[model samples]
Target: MNKLKNKVMLRGALSMLLLAGLGFHSFAQKKNWQNLDLQKDSVFGIDTEKAYEELLKGKKSAPVLVGVLDGGVDINHEDLKRVIWVNKKEKAGNGKDDDKNGYIDDVNGWNFLGSAKGSVSHEALELTRILRRDKAKFENVTAAIVKPADSAAFNQYLKAKIDFEKQTDEAKNAVANIGGLKTVLDSMVKKMGKEKPELADFQNFKAESSIEDRLKRIMVSQLQNSTFEAFYSSQIVKGLEHYQDQLDYNLNPDFDPRPELVGDNYADSQQRNYGSNDVKGPDASHGTHVSGIIAADRTNTIGIQGVADNVMIMGVRAVPDGDERDKDVANSIRYAVANGAKVLNMSFGKGYSWDKKAVDEAVKYAVSKDVLLVQAAGNDNKNLDVEKSFPDRRYEDGGVASSYIVVGASGPNDDKTLKADFSNYGKTTVDVFAPGVQIYSTVPDNKYEAYNGTSMASPVVAGLAALIRSYYPKLTAVQVKEIILKSVVKVNHNVDIEMEEGIAPKSVPFADLCITGGIVNAYEALKLAATYK
Candidate 1:
């Protein structure tokens, strides 16, 4: 789904292969561009170092508990071990409910996708589930003969069918294109007789046919951004595997895994007694990266400095490879809130919702406890005013939720590309922007890499919120959200935006993309936060 940014991610790989581009920034100099100050670095960053140096010089901060609601987190990473949240009241691997919270152990956090045996790594998309359930009733029905009583169901079924077909087709074509490109890369390596070819080795060579020309384009693009060896080894393999997983599991109707894997009653929305205490599930890359961005130990001075210093990261493993169940999301929110989390970073979203009411009640529950909720604005590049991005701040009944902030992705440069081309935006939907493009953070296995998407952006804001709450312990969640929104570095110039892919880009005021009309700045926010107290 576009919410996960997987579709755009695949397209970006293919598009890069098709283009012949040039490098702008060298890898050695871009260690942490996202944390730099805009006035000093000529980029739109949060000015984290400035906040720490100029404002918070020798002040002591109270510890704040923040939750990351995503796939899972590697709490044992080098830079994360000391900062990871630990349930001191419960003992680890006790084989009994130590905290009496219905979950055994309850050490790190809960994993709703786990069972007594193993955990679920992959599942079908929400659209695929819709098609599978409604195919029997609406597959043969015509639009002309549809009754008003079943109008909503029929329309939903038809929309799901169209989207499912289009996504599957895109995945199939991408697989074929990537396969052909791999063949071209291998043949070039053999013909050139070089372990790592240079730009001149392929760009200056004369093409014999269309396939050769395609290979030249691919080589030139790869050589511009990185060494041909790195691109060939990393992106190509990742692209093929990502699309293949979509076909085999995400878009496949017969690939349901909840029955055998989760062992929970699929029909029960209120059943919260399932799941295990395995916080670090099969895939912890996304969650681990987000955790590092939020509160990775700054005192360790090893991998990277997280935005907030005195905050503990609690891992709530609710999201998976595909769409997360609404029950899991609701339970995750309640569990985190009940465990004394002052802020929750929700970095996952979906285009369709199976049960929104359950999720709405959870958000309401969080707000009632004065916990701030930070969410990603999605990566579809579509105007959120007209698009359907599920799990937004808007409740199912009426008004939007309080103490909630929606973040859009911002680039390093404050130019025509200031807004990430893939970030979803709206004049009122998106609350603020944060540095997300090429954001360097920690991944699994004690490693780090740069990842793009609003997923990365959400954690940046969450980290900032945690930073504010740490210093001003008496501030409410709504006050933190207001301070962040009011302290953004506003842009007064006209900027370009592409609402949809393959469409002509439109130039609008920078303020039109979001309500704040600016990107998040920690230095300014902290300066303003002091006055609120």
Candidate 2:
């Protein structure tokens, strides 16, 4: 058993090395491909610009409302401002709930992560919360003492606690290692009397001693594979800071930011109207990017065009910097459905769900209202058929929700590396793949940036669904879902995709990664929508 475990560990380490090498290549490729014309790009993009120019030309399309349930959205973003959803029934800045829909002053949309005073940016991870909430009940208690009804809860608590401890240790170690590397890089840069030293500079610099010579050689070797600007960007520093914050806040069981911010009974799913109206809460980058992907103004030449033209992006802020609560997710879904949103985009997800029943019921309600749901398949790079992801398409009664669509990320290249190394896939669960890696979209404060994730992939599909609903207003949510699934551009060849960080790349049929075995094509989907009865 020990030998087997050691072999598995070695394989895992090799997998990580392979992934790192591939990721470096992917980054360079993204920089080169960003300049391609949107209309003619065949590198995994859905060909939305071509669809508009050809199939959708001179066709009247109804406005479709797409709910973006995420951290928050900058409703006043320049390119996105005109396309934001406005609740006409509710009066803005009034103390009363004018619309009588239980929420007060939800003009732009609702902020379920906020309260009267402020909004929460970070909170405990679900595992940390579970361990904290159940510690007193199960601490030091043996399995023999657990009642038959409490056995499941006890086991859950044990698993959460173990995961929490392991993750916390790993996060701390990563932060320390990154800090050390940054320090060394900073010191080397200072010696060269340059703010951003190049690899050539390090290679030519004479060392004062053997120790200095060894350090210089090491730094030169590391810098050879990456550009100075790309390797030492403010984003990397910010990412390190975020990981530190995760250890200080998310993994700390006693750290509860909700009381000082949201001030809601998080355990109570019945309390519907507790949050504030700050739609553009603390951080709007994630939600704003997602919103722009679905419905940025197509006519505006200032920024990139969105996938769908006639779309009103309804901002439903529910996700925080950490894992979103099941209560907030449920409320966000119901709010979107009740407010005439035809398509809901959920770009955030976590491993554990505290109130899955509530969320499941909310999904059922959305299906009843004929609202289509689009969710990210996650970024764990694991097969969902073996491991579970939250906010999945499975219903509580062991049925599948027809209105739900789960998306996986795909890269620009259509060859063996077409599947994103970070995207999670499942032959049974994932519906389709879309262009997600290095997707350029709107960020907060009218800026644009490229981000990669299944998070980006989900909005791409949501935007396509909105387009289908806009042009074919007669089609129901289920029909639109079917059309998108059936109309994908199938990749018939087998492709190599990473199953995990430390595992060997597996060459599986591209179809086996998703139900449709194809990447989404907006042009094809629009054509199919027109033909569907």
Best by lDDT: 1
lDDT of 2 by residue, 102-171 (tens): 9999998999987888998877888888998899999989898898999988998988888888878766
lDDT score for candidate 1 against the true structure: 0.85
RMSD in Å for model 1 = 2.3
Candidate 1 lDDT over residue span 258-290, tens digit each: 889789987788888788888889999889988
For each of the candidates, give the backbone clash count.
0, 1
For each candidate, the alpha-carbon lDDT, in order, equals: 0.85, 0.80
**Residue pairs clashing, model 1:** none
lDDT of 2 at 373: 98
Give lDDT: candidate 1, residue 159. 89
Q: Which ten residues in a row have the lowest lDDT in candidate 2?
A: 1-10
